[model samples]
Each structure stands twice: as C-alpha cells, then as structure tokens.
Target: MKLGVVGKGGAGKTTVAALLAEAYVAEGRRVVAIDTDSNPNLGISMGLSLEETEAVPVLPRSMLVGVQGDVTADELIGEYGTDTPVGATLLSAIKVTEAGAGCTCGGHATVRSLLSDALADRADVTLIDMEAGLEHLSRSGGTLAHADVLLVVMEPSRKGVLTAARTLPLAEELGIPFTVGLGNKAKRPDDRRFFEDLCAEHGVPLAGVVPHDDDVVAAGRTGRCLTASSAPAVRAEIDAVIAHLDALTG
Candidate 1:
C-alpha cells in the first residue's frame, strides 16, 4: 500500500506516517517512507539523529528534471535513498533553502519522479509525508492518483476542518482512488465527531482519530522516536485508523 498523508502545517500528518511506517516494519514488511516536505524530518522521526540524516546528502535535484547530466530513476533512488535505522527505506526531497529559499522550482518535480518510481515497483507498503495543503503534488505536474490511499488529517478546529474540506476534492480531482479524512490531536470524543461530521458533509469517509497526548509532545522535547515514546492510547487510535485502511484493501 502506498499511503499519502497530508494536512495543515502543524498537524501531525508526519507523526502518523512515521508511526505507520514503523508499525508496518515491525510486522516484517518492507516499508519505504518518503518525506515530501521541504523541511524533511522523517528520518529523525524514524529514529535517525539530525546529524546522521544531515550527512545523507540531499537527493540530487538534477535526477528528476532531466538536466544535461540527469541521473536515471534507478540511479537516483539507489545512490541517495538510505535504509533507515527504523527498518524503512527513506528518501527526502530537497529542502527549500537548499534550492534557494524563495524558489522551489524543480524540487516538487524531483519528488514526483521518486514517487513514480517507488510506486512502479511492488512493495509491502509505502508512506508519503506531504507538505501542507493539497497544492504540492499538483504543482509538481503529477497526480497522487496512483497511491492506494490518500489521507487528509485534520485537527478539529475551524481551520483544520476547512483545510480538509478543500483538500478532499483536490485529491479526488486528481483521481486519487481512495482518499479519506483523519482527525488528529483530539482531546475528547466530540473532537473526533467534529471531523466525522465534516467528512460526512463533504462526502469523504473518516478513517479514524488520534487523540491528543502529552506524550506525543514530550517525545518532541526529549528528541525520541514517537513509535517508542507515544502513549498507548495514541498508538491504539492509529491502529484503528490502519485497520480502517486495511479493510478497504482487496
């Protein structure tokens, strides 16, 4: 399964992807987690230290755009993709600043190529951590239509819910076969309902919810992997979401 997780900037989409990738790996699946965000931290979230990931070199930009000496898909993923400590292969899109802060011209194009190549091969599972908003993939002149599941996560606030509403259609417009909504950072039962109602109103099914857990926040402060430090409740919620996803699989 290739699952693309997207939402607002501060939403926990990356957290969801990291946890899912680890869970799949624990089940002995060969998982590949792609960080499509400009500020790539999936490596750290998967347990690699900031310094260790820094040395992994940005994926060569030339590989995707067909520059004079552009590298082939096999060459690109082979040379730059790293086998993470968490048992998942990782590929980070070039950081915005690395390609010039204000302009990310070919950056998305690069990830588009990576995503295409990754999906072309059969794998146990692949999780994509996308940048905020639905524009990123479209802007790349590509469609996430090939991904098995496209999850739009929200936070139960007006802004969060509204963003999910806008994102759902964009994914569908791109022909994303099985797009769904997910509520994150919930503090109470009503929080989950808010997103569920929004999903119903917008015609998108709700996958499930992840409740607010201080342990999730604490993991960030202590610089530890969330799969190891997150509260059991948080993991349980995510497991529920994954179950919902699996049920859709043939």
Candidate 2:
C-alpha cells in the first residue's frame, strides 16, 4: 500500500503517520516511511533520538534539481534511507537548513518520482507524511499523486475541517483512488460530532476518530516513541482506522 497522510498543521497527521507505520511494522510488514514536510520530524516520532533524527541524511536539493526521475527504488533508498528503531526505513524528503536554500519544488518532484516508481511495489507498506495543508495537492507533480490512499486528518475546528474539505476534491483531481477524512483530538462530547457532521456535510468520507489522550502529550514531553502499550486507546483507534482503510482500498 502506498499511503499518504495529509492535514493542516496541528491536525495530528504526523502522529497518525508514525502510528500507522509502527503498526504496520508490528504486523511483520516491510515498511518505508517518508517525511516530506519541510519541517521534518517524522524520524523522532518513529523512535529515533534527536541527534539521530538530525543526522539522518535528507535527499539533497542539488541531486533533485531538474531530476530526470531515472533513479531506481534500491538506489534511492540504499543511498539515503536510514533504519528506524521500529524496523522501518525512514527517508526525509526536504529540509531548509541554510539561509539561501531555494524553493522546495525539486524536493516535491523527487518525492513524486519516488512514489510512482518501483518503490511503491518494493515495500509491503509505504507511508508518506506529506507537507501540511492544500499546497501540496495544488502543485504540479505533487507527492501524493500516485498514492493509493490519502488520509486527510482534521482537528475539531472550522479551519481544520475546511482544510480537509478543500483537500478531498484536490485528491480526486490528482486522481488519487481513495481519500478519507479522520478526526483527531476530539475531547468534548460535541467535538467528535462536530467533525463527523462537517465531514458528512462537506462530502468527506469519514474514516475513524482518535480522541484526545494525555498519553500522546506525555510521550511528546518525554521524547519517547509512542507504542501500542503506551497509548492503547489511541492505538486501538488507529488500528481501526487502518482496518477501515484496508476495507476501502482492498
């Protein structure tokens, strides 16, 4: 499965991507997790220490500039991918490290090429933590174009829902086969219902809900990997969400 997880900032898309990658790893699947965010942090979320995450090499902008899309799966991954503690290979797409780093158009092109290449078939599961918001979908040769499924995560807020609402049609425009809306961080009685109704009203297919959990917050504070044992309830919801995705895509 080639899955892309996207959302507005703070909508828990990174958390969702990390959880899904780890969950698939636990199921004995070969997984590759790609972080396409300019502010990349999926490495740390996947259990790499801060130093390790920083040290993981990102796809160089120079190599990607005017890329001919000729690289093979093994070549690209073997050269740049790093192994995470959770048994998944992690690849960082782009990071603005210097003052005059040019625009990330090349980085987006590289990710788009990677997703469409044989890399899609090389892993049992390939998950991309796409750049936040609708810009990615709007760009030509965007990263998620070839994704088998796109998870549009939304928080319990109007802006979050609006982002998801705007993203669903763009996913279709990109010819992504499946796109679903996920509600995250629902704390109040109406929070879950709020997203549910808004998604329904906006024609966004509902996936599943992950409620607000202190364990997630605590794990972030301690700089630790959130495991199924650490946050069983959230993991349970994520597992169900994965199952829902499976049923839809399969």
Candidate 3:
C-alpha cells in the first residue's frame, strides 16, 4: 500500500507520517519512506541523520515550465541531478545529512519521480511524507495517483479545521481516491468531538484522534520517532489510525 500524508505547515503531518512508517517497519514490512517536503525532516523523525546522496537533484528552471514533460523519467534522472558540492567552503553552505543535502529548484518533482521509479517493481508498502500542501504532488503529474490513501493531518484549532476543508477540494480534483482526516494534538474528549464534527461537516472521514503528548514534542527535539518513545496511549491512538487506513485500502 502507498500512503501520502499531507496538511498545512505545523499541523503535525510529518509526525503522523513518521509514526505510520515506524508502525509499518515494526510489522516486518519493507517500507520505503519518501520525504518530498522541502523541510526534509522525515529522516530526522525516523532517527536517521540527513545525507547528501538522498538529496534529490533539482531540475533546471526551464524544466519547470513543461519543457521537460516529453523527457523520459530515466532521461531526466540521468541528466538532471548533480552531486553534492565539494570543498570546505561549498560544504559549509551545502551541509549534507542523512535526510538529504540542501537542494535548489524543482527538487520536489525530482524526488517524486525517483520514488515512483524505485517503488515500481517492489510490492513493499510506500509512505510519502509530502509537502504541507498537495501542490507538490499536483505539480508532479499527480504523484499520488497510485496512492491507496491520502491522510490529512490536522490539529484541534479553527484554522486547522478550515485548512482541512480547503484541502478536500484539491484532493478531489487530483482523484486521490481515498482521503481521511486525522486530528492530532488532542488534549481532551471535547477536542476529539470538535474535530469529529469538523470532519463530518466537511464531508471528510475521521480516521482517528491523537492526544497531545509531551513525549511527542521531546522526540521531535531529540530527532527521534515518537513511536519509539511514546506512551501506550499514544501508541494505541496511532495504531487505531493505521488500522483505519489499512481497512480503507483493503
């Protein structure tokens, strides 16, 4: 199964994706987690450092205007990306980590194509940590076209709820097939109801609610997967979310 996680910035979308990937990995599944977000912190959340090679090469500016559409994926892969810069001065600016080195323009599309190609033959579960919005996927010729599920993460706030509503139409236009809303940072039963009502009013499915956990915040600061340090409550919530996703895609 291929799952795409998305939401507005600061909505805990990356956290959700990280935990979901961890869940899959722990199940003895060979999982490929692709970080297509410009922030590129999925690796960090997964307890891995950023690396230069993982950085997807940025396509040239001209290619952004559709001139490169005719080019085969292989051709684009062979011709577009560049190696990490060398030397102390360049290295300082290009600081490489296990997650990825810094990239320039059109890097998201390059990464999306690479991921699509890498997963073409494999039947392993693929989880995409998409950009905060669906724009990146939309631009890359519906990169999530094959995704069995699109998970939108939202916090318990009026703005966050509104953002989920706003994203629903975009997901529909892209033919995302299955889209569900996950309410993160819930602190109380009331918070859960708020999000559930928001989803119902917006016509989006409520996958599950994850309560606020200090461990989740601390894990992020220490660059660790929350699932690794999370309390049983947190783990249970995440498990419920994943189960819902699995059922949806089943």
Candidate 4:
C-alpha cells in the first residue's frame, strides 16, 4: 500500500506519516516512509536521532546526471536508498548541503525519478510524507499516476477544506484510485464535525480526524520524535485513520 500524506505546512503530515510507519511496522510489515518533503525533517519525526538525520546521505549529484542526461530511477534508489530506525527505509528528495544553494532542480529530479518508477513497491506499506500543497502532484504526475491512495490533511478552515476538495479531482486525474480528507489539529470535538460537514458540503471525502495535543506540539518544538511521545490520544487517532484506510483499500 503506497500512501501519500499531503497538507498545509503546519498541518502535521509528517507526524501522521511517522505514526503510520510505526503502526505498520508494529504490524510486522516492511514499511518504507519516504520523506519527499524538501525540508527533510521527517526523519526527526520518525525517531531518528539528530546525529543520524545529519548523517543521512543525500542523493548524490552524480545520481541526478548521467551520460544519458538523467539517471534512471532504479539507479538512484539502488545507490541512495537510506534505511532508518523502526523498520522503515527513507529517501529524502532534498540533497543536504552546506552551500545552501538555490534552484533545487536536483531534488525535484530525484523525486520525479522515484515517482516515475514504482519505487514504493520496495516496501509492504510505502507511506510518503509529501511537501506542503499539491505542486508536487503537478510536477510529478507520473509518480502519483497510479497511486493506491492519498490522504489530504487539513486544518479545519474554509481554505483548507476547499483546497482539499479541489485536490480530489487532480488526484483522480492522476489515476489515484482513492483519496480522503484527514482533519489534523482539531482543537475541539466540533472541529472534527466542522471538517466533515465542510467536506460533505464541498464534495470531499472526510475519512478521519486527529485531535490537537500538546505532546505533538512539544515534540515538534523540541525536535523529539513522535515514536517517543507519551501521548496515546494522538496515536489512537492515527491508528483510527489507518484502520479506515485499511478497510477502504482492502
């Protein structure tokens, strides 16, 4: 099951993705949580120590360029796939550099290559924490072209809900069979209801909700991993979302 998790910048996509990765790992599945976000902090969320995250090898410059002018996806993954903690293999689309260079074509090229290939097939549950918004889709239609599902996370606002609504058709057009709305950062019970109602009114499929919790915020602030969080409520919400997805995909 290849899953794509996308949302606004602060919508907790990485947190949810990490939870899903760990959930599937606990289920004894081979889970590869691809951190396609350019910022590349999904490792921290997935329980990688600061040192390990710093040591993650970026997709080499050589991998992006070749004699044919663009290396094949197989070549990139074969050489650059980095395994992380918790039975998950991770690949960052962004190359880590001290130079802080501009124009990230190499990163996008790596993403495009991976998407063009069925690279997610390497694991039992391939969960991708995508960068914020839907530009990644437009930029790599072939990657998501036959995806199993997409979980569009939202913050329970009009724009968030409507943007998720607008994304459904594009996912469908990309040949993604299933897409659902995931309400994240809901501060109250009614927040979930509001998200569902908005989805229903706007034609988006509201699959499930993850409530607001200080544990999540604290982990984000301190750079600690969600796998280390003591909060079960946040985890329970993720499990519920995954359960719903399992039923849908099965």
Candidate 5:
C-alpha cells in the first residue's frame, strides 16, 4: 500500500502519517515512512528522540541525481533509510541547510523519483508525509502519481478547507487512484460540519475526522510520540480511516 498524506502546515498530516505507519508496523507490516517536508519532523512524531530525529540523514540532491536508474528504490531505502523507534524505516527527501537556497525543486524531484520507482511487489506499506500546502501537488505531480491513495488533511478553518478544495482536483489531474479528505483537529460540532460541507460541496469523499484531543497537545509538550496507544479517541478515529482506506483499495 502506497499512501501520501498532504495538508497545509498545522493540519496534522504528519501526525496522521506517523500514526498510520506505527499502526501498520504493529500489525507486522514492513513499513517505510518518508518525511518529504522541507522541515522534516516525522521522525519525532514516530517516537524518535530529539537527538535521533536530528540525526536522520537528509537525502542529498546529488545522491538522487547520481543513483537514478542504477539503484532500485529498495536498495536506496536500505542504504540511506533510518529505523524509527516505532519499527518503521524513515527517510527524509530534503532539508533547508542554508539561507538563500531558493525553492526545493530538486528535492521535489527526488521525492518524485523515489515514489515513481517504489517497489510494487513487496508487502511494505509506503507512507509519505508530503510538503505543506498545494505547491507539491502543482510542482511535482509525478511524486505522488503512483500512490494508491492521497489523504488530504483539513481542519475547521477556511484555509484548511480551501487547501483541500484546491488539492483534490490536482490529485485527480495526477491520476492518483483514490483521493479522500481527512478532517483533523475538529473541535466543535460546527467544526466537523464545516469539513463535511466542504467535502460535499467539492464532490470529494470524506474519509474521517480526528477530534481535537488534549492528549495530542500533552504529547507534544512532553516530547513524546502521539500514537493511538497514547490517545484512545485518536486511535478510534485513525482506525476508521484505515478501514475506509481498506474499503477503497481492498
């Protein structure tokens, strides 16, 4: 299963990705979680210590360029991927190491290549926590083209809904097989309704909603990983999302 999680910053896409990876790992599936964000922190969400998260190797642009057809995606992952405490192999596509470095077009290409060449025969569940916003959709359609599903995370706010409104069409243009809207951090009755209305208006399928949980906040404050085991309500929500995914692609 190849899944790509995308949303604007603060919408909890990384959280969703990390939880899914951890969930699948606990099920004994070989999982690969790639932090394709410029600000790579999926490692922290996946239960890595601060030192370990910082130590994750940023896949260099030069390596992506050089290893093109010569290396299989699994080989590259085996050579460069870091093992997370949650039992998933983690990789980062790019990082901003210096100021005035310009846009990460090269890094987007790197992710594009990796996803394009991802191994299909393996039983591994590949999850990508993509860069924030819709630029990734516009800039690198090929990056997520091969994905079996795209989870567009949205919150209660207008920007979140707007991002989802813009993103779904792009995923369609890219030919991703299944695209669904995931409502995250929903607090009030209206908050959930807002996402429901937006998805309805946009003609996109609504996957599920994750309520605003204090445990999620506490976990971040304590530098702890926020897994389903840590938050019961969150576990229920994510399990529904998983079931929705299975129904879509089973």
Candidate 6:
C-alpha cells in the first residue's frame, strides 16, 4: 500500500508518519518512508541518525531549474538528466535534512516519478510524509495521485480542523481515492468526541484518535522513535490507526 501523510506545520504529521513506518516494518514488510517535507526531521523522528553516507546524490543543476517550469519535461528527462542516481537524487531533492545549497528549483516531479518507480518494483509499503500543506501535491504533479490512502493529521484545535478542511479540495482534485482524518494530541476524553463529530460534520472518514502522550513528546525531543518507548497507549493508538488503514485498503 502507498500512503501519504499531510497536515499543517507542527501538526505532528512526521511523528505519525514515523509511527506508521515503524508499524509496517514490525509487520515484516519492506517499507520505505519518504520524507517529502522541507522540515527534513521525519528521519529524526524515525530515530534515523543523519550521516554523510545517507545523503542522496543531488540532481543536476539544469534539471532542478527545469522542474520549476523553466524547461519542458522532455528536456529535463533528456540524456543529461538521465545521469541522476535514480532513488538517491529523488530522495535528496525532498530530503530536507541534507545541508548543501538548497534546491530552490522544483524537483518534486522527478521525486514523484522516482518514488512511483521504486514502489512499482517491490516495496510492500511506501509511506510519504509530505510537506506541511497541499502545495506539494501540485508541485509533485499529484505525486499522491496513486496513493492507496491519504491521511490528514489534526490536533483538537479549531485551527487544525480548519486546516484539514482547507486541504480536502486539493486531495479531491488530485484524485486520491481514500482520505481519512486522524485526531492527534487529544488531551481530554471530550476532545475525542469533538474530533469525531467534526469528522462526521465535515464528511471525512474518521480513522483513529490518538491521545496526547508524554512519551511522544519525549521521543520527539530526543529525536527517537516512539515505537521503542514503553508507552502502551501510544502504541495501541497507532496500531488502531494501522488496522483502520488496512481495512480501508484491503
């Protein structure tokens, strides 16, 4: 299954994505968690230490500019562009953590193509932690176009629900078949009902509600995966979300 996670900045999208990836890995599936957000902290959330070796080779300078509409697709994919190290270049484009001169040009299309090709090969699951909002969708040419499921993470705040509502139209335009709302960082039992009613009122599928957990906060602060923390509540919530996703895509 291919899943894309999106939300407003600081909405815990990366945390959820990392947990989802960890869940898939625990199921013995070959998973590739793509951090497509400029924040570049998804890997840190997944407990992956950033290293020079993990640096995805950069795309050719000419191809980078072409992605932003400076050139045609044919030209960008021409012989010179073909020299890009397939997955590495694509990942590097989206991998925000790498610190050389930033890719000011748009390479999201190339990133999407590479990700699609990689998924087609043999990955059991590909989870993409998309940049904060729906902007990436257009930039990447509906990279989430073929995603089996699209997950929008929200907190219990009014702003969070509003942001999810704002992103819905874009997901619809992109032809994402299934879209679900996940309530994260719920501090009170009443918040759960609030999110449920909000989802119902908004016509969004309610996947799961994850309570606010201190372990999650600690994990984030330490740049560690919450999966390894001895927090049953957090784990159970993530497992529930995974189960819902499985049932939706089954």
Alpha-carbon deviation at 180 in model 6, angstroms: 0.6
Cα lDDT tens digits, model 5, 1-250, are 8899998888888888988888888778888888888888889999998888888887766345224455667677767789888889898888887999987777777766666645554437889999887777777456787788999888778787778778778888998889898999988978878888878887768899989899888877787898766788888888889889989999
TM-score (all chains, Cα) for each model: 0.87, 0.94, 0.74, 0.85, 0.91, 0.79
RMSD of each: 3.0, 2.2, 7.4, 3.4, 2.2, 6.4
Q: Give me the overall lDDT of model 3.
A: 0.64
lDDT of 5: 0.81
Candidate 6 — which residues are off by over 4 angstroms?
Answer: 50-92, 95-105, 115-117
As for candidate 4, its clashing pairs are none
- Looking at candidate 3, the ten consecutive residues that score lowest on lDDT are 85-94
User: Model 1 reaches what TM-score against the true structure?
Assistant: 0.87
Whose TM-score is greatest here? 2
Give every collision pair in model 2.
none
- Choose the strongest candidate by lDDT: 2
lDDT of 1 at 100: 38
For all candidates in order, the CA lDDT equals 0.74, 0.85, 0.64, 0.75, 0.81, 0.68
Off by over 4 Å in 4: 60-79, 96-106, 112-121, 140-142
Worst ten in a row by lDDT for model 2: 61-70
Total clashing pairs in model 1:
0
lDDT of 5 at 232: 86
Question: Per-residue lDDT of 116-146 in model 4, one digit per residue for the tens?
Answer: 4445445677777888888877864344554
What would the per-residue lDDT of candidate 1 be over residues 87-189, giving only the tens digit for each residue?
8988876576544356554666666655554435535787888888766756645535557788988887878777877876777776677878888899976
lDDT of 2 by residue, 19-70 (tens): 9999898888999998989888898889999999998898865244223545
The list of candidate 2 runs beyond 4 A from truth reads: 62-69
Off by over 4 Å in 1: 62-74, 98-102, 117-122, 143-145, 228-230
